[model samples]
Target: MHAPSQNREFLGVGWRFPLQVTPNGRIAQARHEQRIEEAIVIILSTAPGERPMLPEFGCGIHNTLFAPNDSRTIALVVHQVRQALTRYEARIDVLDVHAENNLDAPNLLLIRINYRVRETNAIGNLVYPFYIREGR
Candidate 1:
């Protein structure tokens, strides 16, 4: 196998989100692009003040958890996501952020994020599902 480039090394590796342990007794790690993607998910999933040491280090979208599934709410979510990623993930340049309603699951909001890896210029996208209403 080829060796990872310096840029890829700069991307860094970290323990996988949810903190899984491998069979060999080591923490599962996410590398390079996968690491960046996981970081994005973590940022979006966490709310400000959720991390005691880093009180302001998360997306503000969680504040709208009970917001109506309407255009105004969607716009706010998009803005929050863009702002959060821009602030936290210095490795990426956010290209676009948009949200769509899940017709079959009315309470679900599907958020799509398009970004470019700054070091390698690689393009990536991730879809994060946000639940606006609790299921019955």
Candidate 2:
């Protein structure tokens, strides 16, 4: 069943994803901490020019896929991610942003974010997967 949109502003934290209407006829929205988490996903997933009226609203990591993954490049990425989140998401206070390689996942760069929910002061962390492939 599609979840119904409670268009009304909710004071809670977690909710369903995809923000789509289910087969039952309802809109999915994030609620508690999940709401904050999902917002991060949306921000990082969005590429510049993808959102109407918010042309500068994405992490733009995808465009940097081919850059050499050296120390300098990685530092730049961390800065960009931090800047994008700081600019677009007002719900969380970013404490730290780190980029590290996942030994098990050679093709991905894990972006770790430590942040606090501004409303509740609840601290949390999220690891966003950034794909990386060796250029031929």
Candidate 3:
């Protein structure tokens, strides 16, 4: 008897869509980085203690979202982002996290992150926008 040759499995990072199902009622799946990106987005958006089971989980930046856009606020965000990623995400090595107040929209912020994918050793960046004190 011979063993079947198989490659590494990647079920993705998040939920599945357009679930695979046929007359036989079998499940279908996909593999890619979109899942990982989605997972990171979710992790970044979730507030700490929002997860009943894991009270310490999440970036917890929502609490400071209303803070004025200033050097202090930016520093807080950088600290929080680094803390959250360091605690939650083990897939990538975070290189840098920066926040820039929008020039045209003072109540907005642009956060940039530089990271290196651990498994493939690929470098990538993530830009997340934050709306501060909206409609104020």
List TM-scores for all candidates, in order: 0.91, 0.79, 0.76
**Once model 3 is optimally superposed onto the true structure by TM-score, how far is the C-alpha of residue 36 displaced, in angstroms?**
2.2
**Lowest summed-lDDT stretch of 10 residues in model 2?**
2-11
Model 2: lDDT of residue 38:
83
- How far residue 26's Cα lies from its native spot in candidate 1, in Å, is 1.7
- What local distance difference test score does each model get? 0.92, 0.78, 0.72
TM-score of 3: 0.76
lDDT of 2 by residue, 1-136 (tens): 4322333234354446665776888776667678778888888898899988988888878677877665766788799889989998887899999998766876678899999877667788999988877575
Candidate 2's displacement at residue 41, Å, is 0.5
Model 1 TM-score is 0.91
Put down candidate 3 lDDT per residue, 40-101, tens digits, no spaces: 66677889989999989899677777787889888898888888887887777888999899
Residue 100, candidate 3: Cα error in Å is 0.4
> Once superposed on the true structure, which residue ranges of model 2 sit more than 4 Å away at CA?
1-15, 20-25
> Which clashing pairs does model 1 show?
none
Which regions in candidate 1 have their CA more than 4 angstroms from the true location?
Answer: 1-6, 134-136
